[model samples]
Target: MSTTNQFQQAAHYARVIAAIARDRPVPPATLSSLHVIANQLDNAANFLDTDAPGPLSSLPIAATEALWLAELFAEDNPATRLPTDFTNYVLHRITGRPLPFPEPMFPLSDRLALQEVELTNRLQYLHDDTDMQVAHPDEWLRAVLSLWQKLLRLAEAVREDNSRSSHQ
Candidate 1:
């Protein structure tokens, strides 16, 4: 696939994670963090679809503008207390641990390509997770933060490869 395709897919996965969380009834703090993540992903992805010029063209405008937001959210001691598990999860993932996600309950849909006719407008809400099912919302948010950085790096590598191949 082309770099653009990889970037697009990376963006989609970011959105997929956000959509998944949106379906759950997480606390406002967690939701706020998710919102920051989703917006950055969306902005970065959308910017890639444009013809912007610069040394940091690979990064989306949102990524540049809000570069430190995720770091702050993942901080051990922030103005607002972050869930310890969430902080741990983010730290571990940043240190190279894999992201944790349950097998999708349904097939992954390409929301960008889905036609209105194929879309289901039903409010697909998730029940409050049991102690075992989720354990905590912070873990989920932390996983998302990790995923964003991972995807960004993957997209950069893909774009670099594509540039090299094209120049040849």
Candidate 2:
């Protein structure tokens, strides 16, 4: 799909997430549609793994813009907490180590510390700049798209590395 179409879909999903964050009621159909879009975007990112440029490398700028928007919308709202299991899952997948329950897992290890720092900075920019008083749907959508793009790149890289190692 074209970048324009991808941005449009990302914007739509961002709107859904924003509504949910705001405690505004989201229709079941809209929620389902957002899920579908998420899955599609994930799949597209996966498919782009075979190519050199990779899908995500082409998306950082847009994703960065989107993240700025999401930060604004999420500022006044309670910080959206990730499930405990999510962190555990990431730790296991990245380190191949079994983490005991209640033990803190550092997501930014030596290898990925720089990347983590960059991502945090971007998020901070979004949080600090978002004007919750003003409904900036465009900004919110841009932020979400940026995040989705980053996820796509990470997924592709992991998949590619796994595939190469398995063949060796």
Best by lDDT: 1
Q: Name the regions of candidate 1 deviating beyond 4 angstroms.
A: 51-68, 74-168
Angstrom error of the Cα, residue 21, model 2: value is 18
Cα lDDT, model 2, residue 118: 60
lDDT (tens digit, per residue) of candidate 1 on 55-90: 442545554343234435435223222222232232
In TM-score terms, candidate 1 sits at 0.36
- Report each candidate's C-alpha RMSD, comma-separated, in the order given: 19.4, 19.3
List clashing residue pairs in candidate 1: none
lDDT of 2 by residue, 1-168 (tens): 455444444444444443433342346653444344334333333333322333543434434333333343233222232112221221222233342122222332344444545655564555445363125645544563354344434444444554664535
Off by over 4 Å in 2: 1-35, 38-111, 132-135, 155-168
CA lDDT scores, all candidates in order: 0.39, 0.38
- Residue 152, candidate 1: Cα error in Å is 22
The Cα error of candidate 1 at residue 164, in Å, is 56
Give, for candidate 1, the lowest lDDT window spanning 10 residues: 119-128
